[model samples]
Target: MPLTPQRAHLQFGVVLLAGALLPALPLAGQQVLSVFAAASLTEAFNDLGRAFERAHPGVTVRLNYSGSQVLATQLEQGARADVLATADQRWMQYARDRRLLAGDAATFARNRLVVVIPRANPGYVEKLQDLTRPGLKLVLAGAQVPAGGYSRESLRRLNGAPGFPAAFDRQVLANLVSEEENVRAVVAKVRLREADAGIAYATDVGARDRDALTILEIPDPYNPIAEYPIAVVAGGHRELAGAFIALVLGPEGQALLATRGFLPPAPRR
Candidate 1:
């Protein structure tokens, strides 16, 4: 019998639906390792992920990037991942406190905050104090984010610096017109000219970013150095996760991270 148009359409729809579900199909003798890491680790971790896959055949590295707090919240809500890396000790502690970790979290990297301005210099920002200029639009990550917290702390420290005004931090905070969920979002808004300036990790201002951004370095004394922590997740693929973590803390991984502008882990106290 000749197929009718309606019946043919139904068969096509079923084929498309089956194709959509293909990702759910399992592959024999293959392993998947899921990693939940902070947004700031995106560049370095992506390189690390690729390196991990190269060394381990038949294994896939699934990476999830977001604000450190959001990652912690997701883990709290039962997100399935084999490894967790955060931009600060706070969220790593958040996970540890809730027993979401398989072992002690290791400090794997460090980063410092910097002020990023559009190359166009829309607000005439030349230095840290310029952040206090009235009506100057500024974007910052939400208070919950590690970069956001470090940014605020660094700003407050500026108040005590010799050249800055006593109300430096407060005035700067008043100019904030938007709060982003992650450091990258803050950088994106500043680059887009949606805001005059933003605070983000120094690593964010890559060669590509430099094309559109003018980075002003914060003083060493006033800068807040962020510590990054990584660990295996409880109830995850512990052995594979440990291998990944070892790679991150190893010479090959450290070199890869350095190429992407991440700092060596601070010396143990």
Candidate 2:
């Protein structure tokens, strides 16, 4: 029987509807989860993502790494993502205040600032005080970034140390040759010898870059502990985000973070 025009139009509409629904079909068996994370977590999170995929077949983790402040701004501007992991609690609070989070946030890890220098040590910067040397070039994360805020705070503590002069912090700030948007960028500058030295999270210098850079540990009194937070983003895959967060806080994830130089979260009493 020949198809009438009206019937043909109805058949085409059904086909279009079916096509639209095909992506959501269970047979497709693929789900993509978007994660926005701080730049310092790049390597460790990538490892964790792979572990997650292995445990949950047919799921893929897509990551966007940037400064915590930048990520909060993106979420506020309506960027779609399943999870947000930041280097500090302040930005997580920013998301919560705006009602962008699906549930309470979890503090997963901690980090500390260290001075990174090229393996060659061109500027001969051996200690924190050496950053004040004349003509030395130093790079740091922008003041708005969590790592930057911590870096400045550490310098202030150094200035107040009994042996250090009052102008210590001011002199170190004078050698600033560049201010990057993220801690990873500061590590990159030091690794590439673009700057004599840069302050970065201890975890930012991964195994791959360790050979190219030298880490100068900051004294306990002068170093500020950086707390990392994770939460599910509102209007996203809440279940999946929660699962990922669990994986991060689980034994395997904590072990991985420790191996990568990140400190484990303080035990709850």
Candidate 3:
């Protein structure tokens, strides 16, 4: 039967529609891998996210960064993600106790605390002793933040140091002008000179912040090592999550973390 012009036009339209849909077929199977990580892991994880995308075609990496406790609370409240990376073992234990994790959490990296002061030295915070000086405005992450806990622990150790005052810990705590939600916020407050000083991870003070701040290193004897842990989240894409974790524990990820100022995972005793 000879086709009419109207029938031919309809057939041509169908052909064009099919062609348009063809290019979209590959995207149908593309999946997003969600990662929830602590704020301190921002740079390292962002780089890892890109690397994972490169290693696994058709997969998109979505990273969510916040305080470890905040991330844990979010997960507890029903937020969903494929992986969770925390700054300390405490919160990973929190997830494990609740069965919010699919597997054992491995310590991937370590960090140490430091005190950052404005470059101009407005607070005249010259040494550890100054942290407890009366009227000194100090900012620290809230006690819930892993960095904050490390900071407090270091302060307590310093309090017992020979030269420090007996009430050094209490005095420093009394100097607190702000308690930020995360370590990054503590760095921000110090950079802005909103607080005379802030206690944050040594890694948190990056090259970008060097011009605006000065770091007073905490002695190793007084500084506590902050352990970072990673694991696959419960009900998540286990295979992909495990793969991502392997990448983190792999050479490439560890090298990347080293460049970001994170210490290698501590050797097991």
TM-score of each: 0.96, 0.88, 0.89
Q: Considering summed lDDT, which 10 consecutive residues are worst modelled in model 1?
A: 21-30
Residue 8, candidate 3: alpha-carbon lDDT:
98
lDDT rank order? 1, 3, 2
Ten contiguous residues minimizing lDDT sum, candidate 2: 23-32
**Is candidate 1 or 2 superior in TM-score?**
1
Ten contiguous residues with the weakest lDDT in model 3: 23-32
TM-score of 3: 0.89
Q: List the residue pairs that clash in candidate 1.
A: none
Top-lDDT candidate index: 1
Which of 1 and 2 is the better model by lDDT?
1
| Highest TM-score model number | 1
Tens digits of per-residue lDDT for model 1, 16-88: 9999888777655689999999998998999999999999989989999999999999999999999999999
